[model samples]
Target: MSVVWYFDFISPFAWLQWPHIKALAEERPVTLRPVLLAGVLDRVGQKGPAEIPAKREFIYRHVLWRARQAGYPLHFPPRHPFNPLAALRLCIAAGSGVPATEAIFDWIWGQGREGDTIEALAPVATGLGIAEPAAAVADPAVKAQLKANFEAAMAEGVFGVPTLSIDGRLFWGSDAHDFALACLRDPDLWEEAEMHRVAHLPVGASRL
Candidate 1:
């Protein structure tokens, strides 16, 4: 079975996890699906890290620290929480393959550039042979595909970006990469008694 990767250009965490996910292509097919992070947050009725002041500061520092420790380049885009619709649509227009995803991620996180608008994304679009970046990304089909991606992610119970769906199981967050790899190599890991126990654990209280 193929791996389904749900990501959003708006997340630095997604950028951090991208390399490892890209490497998975060597072993198995990885489908790169771009969905709007805001849409997912809205669907789950939660605020983004950036929407919380203290959490925003913490996330920026935490990702930088993680990147430094991992030897991955880390650069914040000119702005945080910028609209990523254009970039997402551009990926759809580019066929949503590894190269296109890599270039777009590198453009935003690798180079600390602005990527919210068509003009800002022209370079990446041109590189991908999309002469009219605006027209290509703004095409009705491309827009619909992005919406469909978001809907599909929701249907799969995806609540965040950088989520990997393997064998119908979801492993979320960059921190969970190891667990995901472990599960991938040994699918029976989920069949352990303790795994089932935790999966059905009852909640004692509700936040509301």
Candidate 2:
């Protein structure tokens, strides 16, 4: 089965996870599905880590530590929680291939560039051989494709960026990459007693 990666450019974790997911392309088919993280969060009725004051500060520090530990170069853009609609649509316009996808991630996360506006992302598009970045991303079909991707992600129960779906199982977050890889190597691991127990664990209480 193919690995479907649901992500949004607004997430640094998605950027951090890009290389590992790209590596998987060498072994099997990998599809890059760009969707709006904001839309997903709204649908789930949850605040993003960055949307919470204390968690925002902690998450920034946490990701920095994780980047240092992983030896991945990371620089936050001028801002966090910027609009990523243009960038997401750009991915659809650019065919969502490895090169284009990596370049978009690198432009924002690696180079610490702004991706909220079409003008800010024009260079990335031009470099990728798309002369008219704004026009390309504004295409009706491109916008429609991004919407479709988001709808499909919702249908698949994806609630976060950088979620990996394989063989009907979802592994969310960059930290879960190893576990996803292990499951990929051994699909039957889900059959373990602990796995079954956790799957049906009873909730003692609920905040809702």
Candidate 3:
């Protein structure tokens, strides 16, 4: 089985799942697909966590705590809510492997480096020994690839970063990794009859 990992580099929570995904790669094929979280929110008619102050605060602490628990280093960038277009494009340009993707994640979230602009990202790429950072980011092919990635993700029912899709069954959020792993181990758990039954269940009275 293969796991399609949909992610955006700007998300700290997405960064938290990097290590877990690497671990899972040892067991099965894992493809890292870069998608714009802004595009996802737009398509799903939802606001990002950072757009809600209360949730944003909670997310920061929660992600940090989770990272600590997972023994992964995490530091929020000095400025958040920055456009990750260039970085996302860069990942695609670099072939979206574990090394290149993790390098992008490490520079942005791990070391708290600024990567909002191509100028800012150039140094990070240089540090990672990536050639032609400027050309890579500016390439029209990279831009097209990123757009295609976003569109494909939307078509697959992805509404957020760090989503895992195994044979069209989606498991969203960093916390859902364990559940996705479980699903992978037991493909029979996706009982269609039970799912149809739940889907047709009558709704209880709403408190509202």
Candidate 4:
């Protein structure tokens, strides 16, 4: 069975999880699914961590720390909270695979490049061997695919990037990387009758 990694380039946490998940791909099939984090946040009526003040502060610092710990260079984009629509669309155009996705993430987070617009991203795209990135990003099919991915993610109960889905269960956030790997290693971990029951339970059932 393949594990699905739902991601958005705008998220530093997603960037952090990329290497780990890529390594996991060696052991199991991993599908990289690009979805818009903004759309997910809008649908779930949630806010990005960087949108909140205290969390934003911590995120800036922690992301850098985490990057160092992981041995990856981390640099926040020059502008915070910039639109990621164009970049996301470009990812769709680039096949949404590890190479393209890693290039996109590196351009924004690793190189500290600004990526809010097609104009700003064109050079990065060129460097990544994606010919005509601007035009490809605007292609109708690419646009639709990104939207479809977002909706599909929502339908699958995905509320955040760096989310891993295996056996129909979602493990969210970069912190869940190890747990997801464990689940992949042992599919039987969620094979019990109670696990199946939990999967089908109504939302907020315990609260109700």
| lDDT per model vs. reference | 0.92, 0.91, 0.86, 0.86
- Misplaced by over 4 Å in model 3 are 127-129, 192-196, 199-208
Q: Compute the lDDT for candidate 3.
A: 0.86
Clash totals, every prediction: 0, 0, 0, 0
Best by TM-score: 1
Q: Give the 10-residue window scoring lowest on summed lDDT in candidate 2.
A: 159-168
Candidate 3 Cα deviation (angstroms), residue 167? 0.5
Give the top-scoring candidate (lDDT).
Answer: 1
Off by over 4 Å in 4: 191-208
Query: Please, what are the lDDT tens digits per residue for candidate 3 over residues 34-84?
Result: 999999999899999999999998988888888898898888878988999
Deviation in angstroms for 180 in model 2? 0.3
TM-score, one value per model: 0.98, 0.97, 0.91, 0.89
Per-residue alpha-carbon lDDT of model 2 for 110-176, expressed as tens digits? 9999999989999999888898888898899998899899899999998888899996589999999
Question: What is candidate 4's CA lDDT for residue 131?
Answer: 83
Sliding window of 10 residues with minimal summed lDDT for model 3: 121-130
Model 1 per-residue lDDT tens digits across residues 81-144 = 8999999999999999998999999999999999899899999999999988988987999999
